[model samples]
Target: MWSQLTKKSVWFIGILFLSLNAYAGHHGMKKDIVDVAAGNENFSTLVAAVKAAGLVDTLKGDGPFTVFAPTNDAFAKLPEGTVEMLLKPENKDKLVAILTYHVVAGKVMAADVVKLSQAETVQGGTAMIKVMDGRVMIDNATVTGTDIKASNGVIHVIDTVLMPK
Candidate 1:
């Protein structure tokens, strides 16, 4: 009777431990940059562009990337048919270039971003960073939101879709 009681107690403890670990792991897991963006309705256009450009995997991959993400409204601000043109199959290269232009190769939070004059983009172009009238600007876009944490990196919301020169 003692042996059977001990075995059952041990099994119950083991199951409880495993269950707790699983719960903690699931809740503690932070979503990656792509997942963060995909989960937000404000980034729908940006997410669609990332998917259309075949960049979902690269953005979701490991390693910190700083993305100055434009919202759907920003995409709407573009000339009529511009976003549609960019999403076309034949314009994949252009779309990729444009998308990558928004990403820097490392995780740069808002504090660090304000100190920089320029950042080299993943697309190999330099983005001009400036602070004017107490607001941060990345190229012509205004940094409306900052320090959005993600598993892979960080995202700073911008008011315009940055175009690579």
Candidate 2:
């Protein structure tokens, strides 16, 4: 019964995704990093956190930035209550640090990402990179999608949310 409900939910979500695309704000043309995430249902959790952290305007601003955005499912993988705790007003600084850790100063496409071994994040930490079986891994998270262009920068989807030291 549980499995059946889960399957039905997945099917509903798939249909919703298709409908969402028709009204997506990010579309084929110009959209900033914030817009790109906001327009994508997969990144809804990320968008909420960005807004909560007060980094929405910074990400929406001009100049290239590369963001390895973790999907909603990725956020869900964190310890229970972790997301709720991070969303608290008192945890703003900590949340900002974690979010910034996912961003790089310049736009790095998938092609360029593969050639490098590591890259520094905006949070003043380095993200370790490794390639195994022709797949790029950042820290322990694999890059799922790359070079999702935005007016201000680019976004690459990752399977895990990176934590900053």
Candidate 3:
């Protein structure tokens, strides 16, 4: 009798979970990096650069690449016409350099980030690490959110975009 009751209880719980999930809206879901880049209001420039560099597939690949993605506003911080200039077909290499500058090779978490003085970027350049009074910074940008896990890699959101030297 006890085993029968336990089986019934488990069945009831499973049905209830399925029912709840079935009724809930699907729109409120965590998106992958490609979806995030395409939809998020903050990442327009980054998305454009990814497209320009022919890196959309690469970034969407099984990267585990640490992306220091910049916001639209961050791109605005560049000199006037810079974004337009970089997006041109003739400027593809430059776009690749600038975009890759924001990518680090591995999945570096915030805890690990605090310990390191610098990290090498995918562009074959190094990003300077700075911590000040509990705030963590990469290059000139402040890390707004850290350890955002993705299927391929991780994303650490930054307030400003980093440019290569």
Candidate 4:
């Protein structure tokens, strides 16, 4: 009887551990696009720009948005003072336009992205999509990473910041 009780207790503990792990995994995957971006160090510039442009709430909303997120290095590649200028309150409109240019209306996965020649942006400009030398390009920015799942959408990392013409 003692051995049987011990086995039962062990089984119960094992099930509880598994259950807790599963819940954690699910919770981890539930972060929205903005939250995911903010959690990553590489997206610091992008996150700050979004906050400066007052786009944090919009990006955090229930959007199935596909974001071509540029890294801090990408922002650094811009002409000197460009990011600083855009972050100014007076340039909010331009900043919003530029940021929205990187986002699409829906959760478009990498597989679907490669099939498109161009995608219409939330900024009302169209971004030309091309696959050259086996690398995907959205406008002039090359997609370095793809299909980072968020609760509301997906993120694709880009090596350059996209500008609307």
Candidate 5:
């Protein structure tokens, strides 16, 4: 009877270990940049933009893309009509341009970003990065969170939405 009890205890402990491991790995991004945006509550506008641009699948693809995701509060920083205007069908191209501006081709971490003067965005141009006094600034936005790991890419949360010139 003692042997049987020991076996049961061992099995219970094994199951407990597996459960803890699963929970620890829960926030790991599996669907790449798109999934990062989808899973984050602050990035609802970004998710919607990806869906609108029909780039959800592409962003979810096996690309080590780096995305500077903006929160809904970031979108609100735009002019009163800006968000509404961009959402209109007539502004699809413009919206796509702005959204793409936030993406960089490779997985760049905040530590690496501070060393570069500028990095090319997926929007076809480069953005200036400034690191001073331990604060990392990307153009007009401030880096709120860094090195958020995802399955296909990495995510950095920004306080303001970036716009192309």
Candidate 6:
């Protein structure tokens, strides 16, 4: 009886350990940049633009990209017909340029961003970064949130849609 009880107790403890580890690991897993964007309601417009620009595959690729994602409200803040115009099939190149402008090549978190004066975006232009009064600014837009980790990259939420010059 004693041997049987010990074996049962060991089995129960082993199962409990595995179960807790599995639950913890699942919670700790990070979604990639594209998945993160698609999962969030605030990025709906950005997601639509990415699809319209034919950049879904590229963004979803194995890139440690850093995206300064703009919210739907940010897209709304553009000229009344700008988003509509950009979505047109004929404007694919322009849309691609504009969308790429928001992406940096590496996973630049807020802490590292604050140390930079400017960072070159994938669109071949540099975005001026300013830190003031504990606020971080990328061009005219403000960084509303930061360090949103993804398996393939990171996302920093911005208040304005960045435009390529």
Q: For this target, which candidate reaches the highest TM-score against the unseen true structure?
A: 1
Ranking by TM-score: 1, 4, 6, 2, 5, 3
lDDT of each: 0.95, 0.93, 0.84, 0.96, 0.85, 0.93
* Candidate 1, 1-165: lDDT as tens digits: 999999999999999999998987787567999999999999999999999999999998886899999999999999999999999999999999999999999899999999999999999999999999999999999999999998889999999999998
TM-score of each: 0.86, 0.82, 0.78, 0.85, 0.81, 0.84
Root-mean-square deviation (CA) per prediction = 4.0, 11.5, 7.0, 3.6, 4.3, 4.5
lDDT per residue as tens, model 4, 1-165 = 999999999999999999998997977658899999999999999999999999999998988899999999999999999999999999999999999999999999999999999999999999999999999999899999999999889999999999998
Per-residue lDDT of 59 in model 6: 87
Encode model 6's per-residue lDDT on 71-142: one tens digit a residue: 999999999999999999999999999999999998898899999999999999999999989899999999
Among all windows of ten consecutive residues in candidate 5, which has the lowest summed lDDT? 27-36
- Candidate 4's displacement at residue 71, Å, is 0.6
Candidate number that wins on lDDT, 3 or 5: 5
Worst 10 residues of 2 by lDDT: 21-30
- Candidate 4 — what's its lDDT? 0.96
lDDT of 5 by residue, 57-131 (tens): 878888788988888999989889888888778888998898889899989988898898888999997888998
Winner on TM-score (1 vs 6)? 1
Better of 5 and 6 by TM-score: 6
Model 2 misses residue 102 by how many Å? 0.1
Which ranges of candidate 2 are over 4 A from the true structure?
Answer: 1-29
Task: Give the top-scoring candidate (lDDT).
Answer: 4
Candidate 1: which pairs clash? Answer: none
The lowest-lDDT stretch of 10 consecutive residues in candidate 4 is 24-33
lDDT of 4 at 77: 100
Give residue 50's error in model 2 in angstroms.
Answer: 0.3
Name the runs in model 6 displaced over 4 angstroms: 1-29
Writing each residue's lDDT as its tens digit, candidate 3 over 1-165 gives: 999999999999999988777765353334556666777778878898899889998887766788888888888988899999989999999899988998888778888999999999999999999899899989889998888776567788888878898
